[model samples]
Target: MAQNRDDDANDGSNGTSNRTSGIINSGRRGLMQGAGLGAALSLLGGVSGAGGLISTAQAAEAAFPQHKKWKIVFVNHVTTNPFFVPTQYGIQDACAMFGMDYQWTGSATSDAGEMVRAVNSAIAAKADAIAVPIVDPNAFDKPIQAALDAGIPVFAYNADAPRGKSNPRLAYIGQDLYLSGYQMGERIASLVDSGMVALFIATPGQLNIQPRLDGASDAIKKSGKKIDIQTVATGATVNEELSKIKSFYLGHQDLKGMFAVDAGSTQGVAQVMKESGLPSKGVHGGGFDLLPQTIQLIHEGFLDFTIDQQPYVQGFYTVMEAFVFLASGGLVGPANINTGLKFVTKDTVEPYLNTSTRYEGKTTKPQIVPMKGAIKS
Candidate 1:
């Protein structure tokens, strides 16, 4: 819901506000000296109060040029999913910094057609830029090209087209899905030497998560282990995912491990692992995202780990790319950005459990989170 706000009031603490204030104060002093408005505005072009000049490119790096407020439309596959809360916050924070606005629109379920329609709508409305998760390989290609044809930049976030596939989206800002999944599989192999494991997915074959499944399966196969992997398709909603996971566990009590790739499914695996007391039975469990419950379950030693895909940066960086492209009049090209993946185990999940901030979509209040010790990679 925070993403729905058309205009977010500045708290005057961000760099953008400070820079604008400094510019204004400098302008006032220049005006008092009869230097005129042009001389005052020249400060943005790297003119110092001491009369030193800097290159225009250097000035561009420090401050953006004056421009109209741009609007970005983010078309998502699951508009109301809890996993994307921090992602929307990222969009909001970046947009606020650049004085831009964004609209969060898409299907509540993982409906590629609905998401495609939303993309078309954004293009039709002449949005300054557009962002969307290319959940369907081909569904979004035409719409993205249409947006680009209209001189509007399009960026992909959360999900991307399959590798080596050409879609018109300028860049991708999200995790390296297959690599993350392969690494997860490696972790799974380390945990359970050889046994039955259940891998739950919210939606099967969706570009957003299918690659992870494929990668995990391939990794397990490549390991040449006796692990039996049963891939289950859990529904899109959290409750449905939980029920499906529970049902699968009920049917296969001999499962040695439980895991998932999506947020809701991962949380479901944690829940089922705890409810069934599977960890006590030597059942290893893990998945992805930073859902509060998943973090707690890991802290409690029920789930082995949850991969952190840094969802917030997915939205924030996508907006950053869009902003620079729009601000520079297409001179700055959009490039693929991997937000990154980190394993949040019990040993490393304390900060996640202790802190509640907009950065993690835990709370709406904005504040700098304090660092207490050495940062872990």
Candidate 2:
């Protein structure tokens, strides 16, 4: 499978490419020209060019030079999910770029308690920084505060605490899940005309996906259409999700649309839609994230579209924010970073399927692909 290539490509090995080596050498040369060998060597932590495209070593004379390899602990809600594979790669890339280490630990089953425990453990360890997806609104509030009190910088990624909630996490580095879902709901309203729509969510009431479900529901309802929205829960496992989706389709043969809020559930929706030939029957479907299967299925006309929340940046930016906060000694306070949401449909999935790189969680080999045509938004 394509994902197997992705997994093998990014097996956490520090294998350097010629391109990266060249970039590093260039950065080192620049440092040497500006300072003596000792100074340059000291500055040799990590360097980068515009857009962080060129991997460089760190500057030794950094503003916050403790000589200690700051470790960032990332507590995940679903650590093993393919949707987060690119995210983990992002964290890895950022850590390497910034001369830091990171640990990925959390519940593979999306258990909030397990995630909370991971956060608490990071605090107890007095980690340099902590990054987590605030999957549960209240469960993370106190633990996050504890981390803050312990002097460990905490940042939210992918999922965040709900708005107006006094969770004292410094900032959020992810897409606005609710607004994205609301826009998606508006998209669905444009496509489907007042029929039963089945929206599948892997887990409900979890902040990671609940807001999306709520937003989509609200938007569809606000459309003032007689669209019947029936939500079904697809279990954690991909197999279970697929089975549930198929079962739901079998029961609701007249479903006008099938949508999902998560990656596994989204793929399940596509599989069932393809198997049932729902698109031919004028049934619409789409959801968030770009699972390889989800992209391929969209290309094949089985699925209509998928939203790209840029999962890679969720991790990348979280680490970046944490580094800035730690480096600036709280002078650079954290801010909510919306990673952005984009719609990928048949017309735009070509690049995704054709390219393989860490940016999309596809490959570890870091070579820039040259673009030929004018870009369209």
lDDT of each: 0.79, 0.79
Lowest-sum lDDT 10-residue window in model 2: 17-26
The clash number for model 2 is: 10
Candidate 2 residue-wise lDDT, 147-241, digit = tens: 88888889888888887787788888888999999999999998888889999999888888889999999999999999999999987878889
Return the number of clashes found in candidate 1. Answer: 0
Q: Indicate the residue-level lDDT of 26 in model 1.
A: 16
Model 1 misses residue 355 by how many Å? 0.7
Residues 144-251, candidate 1: write the lDDT tens digits: 998999998999998999999999889999999999999999889888889899999989988889999988888988899999999999988888888899999999
Compared with the true structure, the alpha-carbon lDDT of candidate 2 equals 0.79
